[model samples]
Target chain A: MSDAETTIPRPSLGRLFWVFLVMGATSLGGGVVAYLRTGLVVRQRWLDDVTFVELLSISQTLPGLNATNMSILVGDRLRGGMGALVATLGMCLPGASLMIAAGFLYGAGGDGPWSKAFLHGIAAGAVGLILVVLVQLGAKTLKTFADYVFVVVTAVAVAFFKVPVPYALIAAGIVAIWWHRPRDKDVR
Target chain B: MKQLWDLAGVFAYLSLLTIGGGMAAFPEMKELTVDTYHWVTFPELLHFYSLGQLAPGPNMMMVASIGVTVAHIPGALVALVAFFLPTGLLTFFVGRLWTHLATWRWRPAIQTGLGSVAVGLVLAGAIIMGRGAITQVFFGVIALAVFLLLWRTKINPAYPIVASGLIGMALHYFNIA
Candidate 1:
């Protein structure tokens, strides 16, 4: 890793921000991960696939949006605290501005019947998108029958019983972790 | 004044619930913003969320929309900062420590365990969003078509999603929906 780091020229903070900003502005739809890969690995040659996947795993496990988390991690890796700051800012800026503008338009009576119909249709479509994401995530994460059980139990508790997320996350997380606890025999 | 504080506190708390992805936090987000604080109606929340999909960056940038609706620019800033800061710091520090924990015996267990739970959270969120989004058979057909198209192809999602909105407009034009 150190060898690879030494070989690739580290990007200045401005360039770092620019790279992430372009990705932020271009990653339409929801698959920001793919955009990050193309920008970092294919375009910039900043990180190889292995490192990208490693950072991505950490991003996934943490409690934040993957795009911003990746920005932070990759930024910190390249240029320390300042890099993380700039990268995250760049990644979020375009979207934040657009959504804020959307809020204003919405406040100014943008929700006419026609717009409402459009929003309703998009809302339904977004459900389909989220379902696709859910299916893909399940395929990658779930393996054993017990894993599927955890998924089902957690979903039911939250959706049907109206359990608060914190409580549900903790309860399910603890039990799931215990079930997968390290064993001596498995250490090999 | 109080609303700014409320927005900060709500978004900050909501940010931590986005374990696997932004969608994982959707249900709780709907609860606080709509049911609890009355920041937006349920349908409005759905609209902002759906619009967020077309936005360029993170999927949950709709938080800023909620913030804007509540208190304009300041509200948006506070919500954005609060939403990103705590978890951002956590990721920054934990990401550094992650390399050291690479050899930790329980690492794989934690990863595997959390992966399942994360999927569950996302599933829960999907169910809740579906309840609001799929109000009619026409909408259901749209959703199914989008799902199948995206699932089966490499085409960009923006095309189909945009088409869905246009289909919606057409339905409205004809008074079909």
Candidate 2:
């Protein structure tokens, strides 16, 4: 209900696990934000929008899929260790199982035209989905020209300059860390 | 055993960087699986990339192709599970922390940046992956269309993806691009 209690209102492990299971099968794009917003915020009303944004941010920083991180965060909120495990499994197992099957199919040559057709179709569609998600997120996240500029320059750097991703990441990370250093100090 | 462990290590590293989605890891993924390890050839990566793009879930699922290419069945299992684990755990912790300090120093900025970076990474990935398939005009158009249509339209958009493959196959059938 009201997550207003200061004593760290934990969600029920069982309920979160159930949600985790459902989300595993459905969540796509690796964004996991939509699933969290829909499942936890809108459908279940487990978290408000403010909470969702906060949780989403935390999920991004940690070293994993945003959805997986979300499962854990939600799980821990609800039921600590069990919640974490179930949530992880929920996000991990479905994709892993699918991958294993894909591995088998792929190993078997994936020879059929239908299979090839299916793959080609889906790949193109996925990019479309990616573009949609990108625009949607840009609306939500990048509010300024500078942010858009970063997006443009980053895309150009990778496309035109043939910048290796690791170097790009390292450069971005340094810029981010340094850029934020002043603001971080201000907040502290 | 060493190979399985190697698989584990690769997934772990990839998982860490893969922040927004599976595609985010592609550039690194291409470098590691194709360029560095030669687990698969570049053309093979394009095939896998194309498939991953088409599939419904995470494009990172393309990592499965690497597993299949490596030690077959077992390699796929190892990579899929291992790559996901660290991130799963990390997400759980971060997810919990979301209730507290998401608006705090650096968190908000980092997240905003990640959202943008994820998109950039996907585009970069497409460019890197498309170069391999771009020798022919038809393929080039398909690639460009895929990018443009994705950027421009919201009309469900699945149609182009399905149609493109038929175009490719028909091209092959007719001795075309």
Best by lDDT: 1
Tens digits of per-residue lDDT for model 2, B34-73: 7778887776666676665444334466677688778887
Q: How close is candidate 2 to the true structure, as a TM-score?
A: 0.79
Interface RMSD over true interface Cα atoms for each candidate = 0.7, 3.7
| Candidate 1 error regions (>4 Å) | A1-5
Per residue, candidate 2 scores C-alpha lDDT tens digits across A27-140 of 644435666688887998777887677666665555565656667776766667787777666665666567666667765866676555445444444444555556665676
Error of 2 at B53 (Å): 4.4
Second chain only: TM-score per model? Answer: 0.98, 0.87
Docking quality class, candidate 2: acceptable
Please give the range of 10 consecutive residues that has the lowest summed lDDT in model 2 chain A.
A176-185
Candidate 1, residues A69-158, lDDT tens digits: the string is: 999999999998999999999999999999999999998876799889889889989988988998898888898999999999999999
Docking class of 1: high
Candidate 1 C-alpha error for residue A164, in Å: 0.7
